[model samples]
Target: MHLFELTCTAYFKNDLDFRRSFETISHFITYAMMRGGLDERHTKSGYKHYVFGGLLPLEADKVYKKGSTYRFILRSPDEEFLTALSTALRQNIDHPDFIVVETHLNRRKSFFITELYSATPVIVTSEGNLFWTMEKNGDIMQLQRQLHDNLEKKYQSFYGEEIKAPQNFIQMIEIKNRVPQNIEIHKEGKKIRFFGNKFRIVPNEDEMSQKLAFTALACGLGEKNSYGGGFCLAGGMR
Candidate 1:
């Protein structure tokens, strides 16, 4: 599958907190999609052709400072979709709260091996409840399995074909430096809270493993990705 990455730098006129940044940016994306002529039905469908990482400060711990620039990354499997998004952003360049100062887009080639790291906390669900990766007795093995399964499902749903991975693909995942966090989000006028885990994951260095990692980056690794829950970067950090 093909993928295009868009890195955006937004400058805020007022202080912004990290907790609310994702939600606000997500709203902006939806608005952009609408403005770009994507109907609500297609945008709200089961498959999301795009996944986005969180807004990170250009300088550490400066996310809440006014005039500080923050960066967000968006990945999509469709070049036309990204082009529409870019046009929409340019149309709204003069927004009062924040302005899109710079945007960089790059088309990513296929990789045979890669590392995947969480850009935002990933949310996995278990038994109708939210599951964070680093919970007490949380079974990292199960987490990896579910992550792979979800990625495969999303890839198939979006691209109309199943992704091939090794039989023990989950076994190849190595979790490193996991940090658990609780987050609350307002969606569709409802306030929902859940715990998520942010961590670094290294996939085995093999062709099949690399394809799996690329799938994860294309489709996001866990649940609620369109709502800012499962965004990840191919490398360890931006």
Candidate 2:
């Protein structure tokens, strides 16, 4: 896996609302891919092959101020996608009125993933509805099953292979937030939203566990990852 840190130097022509920045950045990425002549990749249906963090600020609240610098992190296992994205950004990134002053790449492999925390909310749903902790009377096993299944599906989709499923490789875990949060994104003059929650996960000591952890780190944990949901930060990365 590889991570690209994009340093954004802000020169806001209008007030940039942080609340709406996720959707804005998502569109910017689409434009970048199209500009780079990777429109087919961007429009493809399965596994967007990238996950990104929110546009972080140097110091600010809801609205970003001019003359300030900010940044965001994007990760992927696809070298081609990353290369195209970097090339596009270098060519032009003035949409949100921010210039891509710098781009840093960090390469990561399957290291011992001891702990994982949600950098962005993880959106897990069942039967077209959001999964709540109280759905099965706070059953950790049930939640773990869903999580494990989701990881398996994503792994197969991205790697084009079936991984030997370890018996709940993601062991006993605690969710940091009991209350689910909603992440809203605007598209085509309509508002799209998903309910998600953050988690503090611990992986079991198994080879398959290590593989799944790396997949979650590179591809994200749950659904709507292309919109920046389910981005996780693994512990013990060097």
Candidate 3:
């Protein structure tokens, strides 16, 4: 499979509380997509087939400085969509909160990925319930099953192929922050809330395993990906 990455550098126009900035970033992306004549994709139903990360310069204070350049990433297996997004972001250079100063796009083969890290929290859900911790689920095995199943479904949906008998694709490395992070977004005049956890993940050193990791990195790990949940970073590829 093929994957595309877009990195955006912007100058913050105001002091933004990074802790609660996902909503703002989501809107910014939607607006850019709309401006790029992707109104249907911006408003259409079902999976958006793309994912995004939060603003860069990870800070403890959770506040961003005004006029400082910060970076964020967006990835997808759809190159056409990403190309339009890049063009739209570049054309609409100014915004009330930030200015899109630069954007870089790179395409890569999915198999080139050697490492995958969740740059944003991954929201895994089962039977309309959010899976935040193992304690809530009663065991780690159940959580692992849910995570793998979720990724497997996403992989099938994205590629239109089912993975045959295989080992676990995503190997949990570490949960950087154990606490659940809350993501609230305004949709249709109502506020929707979701909880997720940020963690690092690697593959099982097999081709199929890496393909699954790349699916998560390219598309997203769990639900609400268009809102930036499950955004991850793939490394060790040149």
What would the TM-scores of all predictions be?
A: 0.84, 0.87, 0.86
- The TM-score leader among the candidates is 2
Per-residue lDDT tens digits for candidate 2, residues 70-135, read: 677778877667866777866755675565666666666567888989878888776547455454
Better of 2 and 3 by lDDT: 3
- Candidate ranking under TM-score, highest first, comes to 2, 3, 1
TM match of model 2 to true structure? 0.87
Estimate, for each residue in 24-141, the C-alpha lDDT of model 1 and write its tens digit: 7777777767767865624575867677887775346535577777778888777877877877765664444577777888998766544667776677777657565555646767
The candidate that achieves the highest lDDT relative to the unseen native structure: 3
Model 2: number of backbone collisions: 0
RMSD each, Å: 3.1, 2.6, 2.5
Worst 10 residues of 2 by lDDT: 1-10
**Candidate 1, residue 22: lDDT:** 69
Tens-digit per-residue lDDT, 111-206, candidate 3: 666667777777877554755664465455555666677777777877789985287775566667757776787779988788777767666777
